[model samples]
Target: MSSDADRDGDARPGPGRAQRDHWERTYGAHPGMYGDEPSAPAVRAAEVFLALGARNVLELGAGHGRDALFFARSGLTVTAADFSPAGLDQLGARATADGLSDRVTTAVVDVRDPLPFADASVDAVFAHMLLCMALSTEEIHSLVAEVRRVLRPGGTFVYTVRHTGDAHYGAGTGHGDDIWEHGGFAVHFFSRALVDALVEGWTLDEVIAFEEGDLPRRLWRVTQTRR
Candidate 1:
């Protein structure tokens, strides 16, 4: 007998692709889920970019445009990208409402694929809690390479990731490669070594320890510059 799994074939997407559906539903269920305020990291990143005279930025995993809109308001041209179209729609609507449509643009991007921008194109990049998504180590490395490819020389890249010290690090269902799923959300907790490894060939600026949310998720905000 051909079971349901057999009939469906082996076309199932990996956890990373499945996350797109989860995020779509999440955004649909709760628009502006992360609130309208810019996160602490975004505010700090803006300071860094402005100090460096950065005029444009590419933001990955930009959900609902809270930080992207903030960057636009800070007088930087912004490109916001995420895998979920629903999230981008909300971001677009909010940008229009805030009269930031001209300053901000939205693109649906899966970081696993090559980035859409040209080489040495952007002045800065910011990703908050993005690298910690259900991506594997190899995918993370590839995405970082793409980030470097798109950023101009001396461009700044600021990103945050939930680290191994987080309360939920070993909790929930383990999906291998340090990925854990809880309440429909999957995360790849980062080790210190992994963080150091990602900075290869770049000038490592600083790694700050921080906490966020009710769970007080432990995270490291990493800043680096292209040599």
Candidate 2:
């Protein structure tokens, strides 16, 4: 939770211990996992920013920099941070291959702690498919607080998370969730009321809950501005 820990160049154990370990093992076992595309929610949220002429975006939990690459290519200064070193490595490689090495900067840091950037240094913070899987409500609040701390007044926080109404909430998808085991961790499902309370100080600009494809998925798309 310390600022030094967040900006630390060295890796250290943090609050997201189980979540980090789960992703490390998951991505390690299947290096090519998740392919090389940004999540649909990420793409949609980025488009909203583009239309609004927002730049200097930061992506928390940027798994493999898929969305980071897209933002960079769209002419936004992007800083993508992830807790997993392996994920950042893949992101760097992908950026290099896509000729986006100059546009994107990859950082291996935990967002549950203080972020590396200076206060109010970014125009927007994007967290796609992040923040919902924390084992505790405190962790989720901490993550949201960090986002608010780094954003300037009126700055936007755009993110998506698995909806509580989804059928996969209690079911194990072979990728954690279900029961909280050693390798497996807790996944918190959020409802609209929960999200509203989480962003109390912020002005809610938009909220969308929709199902994607054939998977009984529920995605909460929230766009909020700092108060």
Candidate 3:
């Protein structure tokens, strides 16, 4: 586990580093901020994984382990990675308390960095809202490439992203690259073209539209397969 100081982002570069610090502080202030219920995307991802006989799942940007815990309970070994140490701490504690620690591992990982896993080592990868963070289009592409590198052949990748149709899409302070900041959080709203570009090297399974939260965040729940 990284020390709380390491998560403070004093030495890291880019706006992403600042976002990391924001998440760290946010998690510190409100542990389990997203609550414990598994996201609908996560629930659906688990079914896909299990149907494929997937034994392990890698969850990127796994804030406080809501979905990680759910995956574990559903009998998949889970690696939950997030940039926020405070969030992972809560996740770890919850796993231990629920006796799910044996199936769950936590790591402090920034998506801007390369994933720590070896190539073709992960059975599946799931990210609920990670790709829509304060990341450049190039950075998002790079991260998806990393996801491809780590996932095995025939592995599934399920992710969700806020889209241009969202109510908040044009309401926030623009940061270029389709990214915007609102209420101290930055989001890169996805366009359909961006989504199509990302599936170039993979088998695009589905892009289902959905809505969530009080703001009724408009999102695309995308599923693809490693080819």
Candidate 4:
């Protein structure tokens, strides 16, 4: 098997075609790798979304449509987008199975480029474990800007990323706050200060840092209004 670092090194953009092809192959090989359920952080983020009374919700990298399904089940209009057609296929199947075909819409989108939505079209945007996949800080910032651009005035942007202070910073071992690059793919770490700087226009609502077992994690829940 190829190491994570090897995979990170091979993961790069190529006129959209290559990127889409790569993820398609990956998801095709492992149809439901991310499973049919949302992660713990996503569940936690949903609580905040519920409290905010958000109606039109966008999941930037909706891998398996897990969180998207959660929002749809709550009666929110959801647009679940991913870069991989294979992933979207699985998500669509899951949505149909959950009887959310009407409430959930699936799209193939790559966040590294301009988002496929009109400005201020979405009420809230949620991305779980999406930022770290970016190859560089510039890409990360661009993704954030895209999220900001699509969000309505006073919309909320909630996401969770690996904590920077973790012990295994960058080995693709899910440790520490280091940038792990392997097999054309990478995971970037972020500190609270870095996130604040990246999210320049957004208000810093809350930065929660905690350890899950041996790993340290950070949850950033920010609510920003359009300026």
RMSD of each: 5.4, 4.2, 2.1, 6.1
Q: What is the C-alpha lDDT profile of model 3 across 173-195, one tens digit per residue? A: 88888888899999999999999
User: Scored by CA lDDT, what does every candidate get?
Assistant: 0.91, 0.74, 0.91, 0.70
Better of 2 and 3 by TM-score: 3
Model 3: what TM-score?
Answer: 0.95
Ten-residue stretch with the least lDDT total in model 2: 174-183
Task: Report the lDDT tens digits of candidate 1 across residue range 169-209.
Answer: 99999999999998889999999999999987789999999
Error of 4 at 7 (Å): 18
lDDT of 4 by residue, 1-227 (tens): 00122222434543234444566788899888866666766677677777877888898778777788888887788999887767888889988887889988887776766777889998888887677664356777888888888888788888767656655455554322356644544457776666777668877677666554334544444444444
User: Global lDDT for candidate 2?
Assistant: 0.74
All candidates in order of TM-score, best leading: 3, 1, 2, 4
What lDDT would candidate 3 get against the real structure? 0.91
